[model samples]
Target: MQPYAQNWTHVTEFVMVGFAGVHEARLLFFTVFLTMYLFTLVENLAIILVVALNHRLHRPMYFFLTHLSCLEIWYTSVTVPKMLAGFIGVDGGKNISYTGCLSQLFIFTFLGATECFLLAAMAYDRYVAICMPLRYGALVSWGTCIRLAAACWLVGLLTPVLPIYLMSQLTFCGPNVIDHFFCDVSPLLALSCSDVTLKETTDFLVSLMVLLVSSTVISVSYGNIVWTLLHIRSAAERRKAFSTCAAHLTVVSLFYGTLFFMYVRTKVASSINFNKVVSVFYSIVTPMLNPLIYSLRNKEVKGALGRAFSLRSWKGQ
Candidate 1:
């Protein structure tokens, strides 16, 4: 192993060259990102607020969704604000300190992994509701849901610690400029001058463990759901059951699909400009859409929204 310069000699700050070649459209970029950021915050907050205030939505599905909304709030925040700042005066986001960068990376990874686990838990809840309606009440009691949610958060918080610690011990004697919107693991790894093989391998194993396990749970749950749906004599009941899982399935595909491409792939071209866009998609777009996808299509959420608004109007009168 080559000796790196001492801490004082290492670069303390990194330049984030976000959305390169868009200098002329800075305002456009800022406005768009700011709008999306506000939307994500508002929509997710509304979900959390609605689920909290409305007794009608206090069931297991919405319980998980409330937590998901809470997670989305932080997940999108970890990256969008910095990305928005990058669009400021020329070379704006070029000053993130090493500590700040790692903090962002850790929080981002934690929330993302938590969402993966939470989604799978929700899938299991759906499977129990559909495939074993007779046992639904006992199978997914409120206490069980709470424990599952707790596990998701606790496990997620632990997932990135080892990898981040390993990465932190590495020397960053190379260029301090990151070519992406945020301090993602891949871009950060690319900037390190030290041997990153161990860190990379650890990251891969951890990612595989999280994604593969969650995906397998979801797949098995859904497979059972399909089998049960087929056995049902009524087509309407089948459709209703399937509809309930549709939004979550869409969210899972959007999230896991992009995640697999970003982290699981064997080789990510160093010069590829598409990575930032993909990062934006998950870190920003997905959070903004989760509420819309889940709430708009969900009849109970819509009913609750209607009631919440009606009550507000009546009080104003």
Candidate 2:
């Protein structure tokens, strides 16, 4: 790492040089990304509405699913709109104010961390439901669900404060260009003129703790779930139990796989283009697929969607 220059002028804004090599295809990229952003929003909104309006779907699992959908809406919003703006070259599109950049970084970190904990909570809910069928109600009552959800949000809210503060203290002297579409920790750290060893270590530790704790819960919960599923006498019952877990597991894999690759490292040494590509998967693509994954895989969500569409058709008549 280079030492901070003594005669450097402070940068008040950052130019996000997104996909600079592909500027000729801006329209094509804009169209595709915009379509994806809108689809993600609509899909997640549908999940929330479906879970809210259908009484039969009003259970702990759906409750958590609704929260997840809501988080996805905010999570995708943090980056995609700015990215879309950059694509079209509108509203100083690629240029973000220093404060705006930091704010984006904070909110993005908060929501991302919140989702990790929320996923863990959902896994625990499933464990209780499947591994302790008789006590599911008492174990995961409405009050308990609210408290668990609140705790997840609270922890997420706090997780990014220290890191953002540390990042805010770093100096950005000159050449204030970010190589990615969004102001992520790595890209931001890469642009810093100050020594970023502390920030990098903090970021790595924070990400490691969040991933380790959440993944542990998910792993243990699924382990127990698999064990219980094996003891079922009827093959139909086993399949049914496994089906419920499969969607959640798939989602966990998608969310964590990219995250581990993106944030767990101690240094910002990866190819910037590669980082951007990986970011798209978790930041844009995963959220869009989540609602589809749940709705397609879970019968209750599908039935609710069916009822919703039928009600709309009846109203049209």
Candidate 3:
């Protein structure tokens, strides 16, 4: 490693070469991304409607589900829309100005950090539901849920701006080319001409907290949930309990899988591409999938959605 001041002098605004050299496949890329974004929006909106109108779905599990859907939609929007625009090859490989880069970083970090907290809240909800059903309503009351939701949003919102400010202080005097697709912390850090000692440490520690700590909470919480479920005597109740958790499990796995893959980099560019692909999953595809996964497999959501839509149709008539 070189001296912090000396080596730092050689960095600037990153030029992101958009996904794959398949700039020629821009049309196909646009079609796929556009379809996915639409799915994300519609499916997440349907989830919100289902959770809102259905008495059964008004519980903590679905309440968090509604917010998670909302987060996913917004989270994906922070990056996917721009990436989709990049698909035209006109703006593809376009040099992102400093402000645009920071905005991307801020939104992405806010949503990503929010996700870490939200997933923890969701797991905690499951724990209460499965371990102490009678007490769950008391434990995860609407007030508690709102507090949790607000905390997720508030902390998520605050966490990124300081870093963005830190990043902003650095001067970009070198090659303006960013190696990856988006304005992620790591890639951005790699391009910074400043004292990144603190920045690098912050990214590593924060990423560790978000990814590892949250994963552990989900692990421990679910472990207890499984243990409690084993004690259920009624097979019907057991099946229902298992099914309720299935959607959350899917979402957690998908999000964690993609996130860890994206940041867990080595000294290889091959892994970078892998990270980008998984990044798309958490950033674009997973949120859209959440509503669909929950809705398709969940009887309550499906029922609620039907009722809400039917009511709407009746009003239209």
Among the numbered candidates, top TM-score falls to 2
Best-to-worst ranking by lDDT: 2, 1, 3
| Model 1 backbone overlap count | 0
lDDT of 2 by residue, 61-98 (tens): 99999999999999999999999999888989999999
Question: Candidate 2 lDDT (Cα, whole model)?
Answer: 0.92
TM-score versus the correct structure, for each prediction: 0.95, 0.97, 0.88
lDDT of 1 by residue, 44-156 (tens): 88888888998878899999999999999989888887787778854555569999999999999999999999999999999999988899999999999999999999999
Pairs of residues clashing in candidate 2: none
Clashing pairs in 3: 12-172, 14-178, 15-176, 15-177, 15-178
Name the regions of candidate 2 deviating beyond 4 angstroms: 1-6, 311-313
Model 1 scores a C-alpha lDDT of 0.88
**Candidate 3: tens digits of C-alpha lDDT, residues 164-253:** 777787767666777677887766666656668776666656676678777898999999988888998999998998897888888889
Error of 3 at 230 (Å): 1.6
Q: Global lDDT of each model? A: 0.88, 0.92, 0.78
Q: List per-candidate RMSD values in Å.
A: 2.0, 1.6, 3.1
Q: Runs in model 1 with CA error above 4 Å? A: 3-8, 90-92, 310-317
TM-score winner, 2 or 3: 2
